[model samples]
Target: MAKDRYAPKTLDDLMANMSSRMSSYVGKSQQLNQHQELLTQCVGATMAQKCRISNYRDSILVIEAESAAVAMRLNYMKMSILSDLRKNGLADLCQIKIQTSPRAAADQQAQKKRSEPIHNSRILSQQTADALLEVAEHAPASLKTKLEKLAALSKKNK
Candidate 1:
């Protein structure tokens, strides 16, 4: 049996064998994440939750704020944020760009909606229940049972 030089022994070895471009992209992603953390710390918890570092390229940091209000606030504090980022090792940092992203706020709202418990508060009225019972009387045995069960819900509701 011949040993395969290209065969990776473990996940770490496989990752280590990744192309230079992929490695560079991963490094850049990690660096951006670190910058995001530093930015959040500089902005404070309240404002940090409303905005995020979207990109860092050409010495310009792009910040995506959830709303216009947040964007305006970030715009007002841009110079301070730039200085803070510079102090935190982004010495080449030149400008801070703030963009209002309604989509981000919409996404958060959708997530909140998904997390909330759905409430079905609809109740069968007595008149509707009576109509169902009347129909159930002439219905086939199988359908009659289901209609009766549905009509019974009104009594339970009352």
Candidate 2:
């Protein structure tokens, strides 16, 4: 045979056969990129030396900052970032993940574990007191007193 003109020959022709699906994919990609930019702005609130957007795919924005300190600082601002993402209506297609390459996400997970309440109690118990001690160990001065009182109150309630 000399040629089969009807055979699928090019990417454009292949896409032409499925324009509806391709258009939706393109639209979603565009929406995701726009939301990623908006969430990227929240990075500046943390005093990050430089915030760069390395990738915006699958609704996850991977950010690279100039330093670990900056990344660590940004960690405390995650909820604010997430709120901004939601307030601006970008939450539907966007999420923020702070990436400091030297420290793995494991570090973040550990930090989160440290930050969150290790135990849930209707009323605080001795175990909760230990959790309070754990929190007080690293709590900032401004928060220490309030947290202490909370721990005390929870303990008394136990």
- Those runs of model 2 whose alpha carbons end farther than 4 Å from true positions after fitting are 1-29, 40-49, 54-61, 93-95, 101-158
The prediction achieving the highest TM-score against the true structure is 1
- After superposition of all CA atoms, the RMSD between model 1 and the true structure is 5.8
- Per-model CA lDDT versus the true structure: 0.91, 0.68
Per-prediction TM-score, please?
Answer: 0.58, 0.38
Backbone clash count, each prediction separately = 0, 0
Q: Encode model 2's per-residue lDDT on 41-151: one tens digit a residue.
A: 665534532454456667766666556876777678777876886777755536778776644445655777999987645776777777886898798987877778877
Residue-wise C-alpha lDDT for candidate 1, range 18-78, written one tens digit per residue: 8666989898899889988999889998899788888999999999999998999898899
- Candidate 2 achieves a global lDDT of 0.68
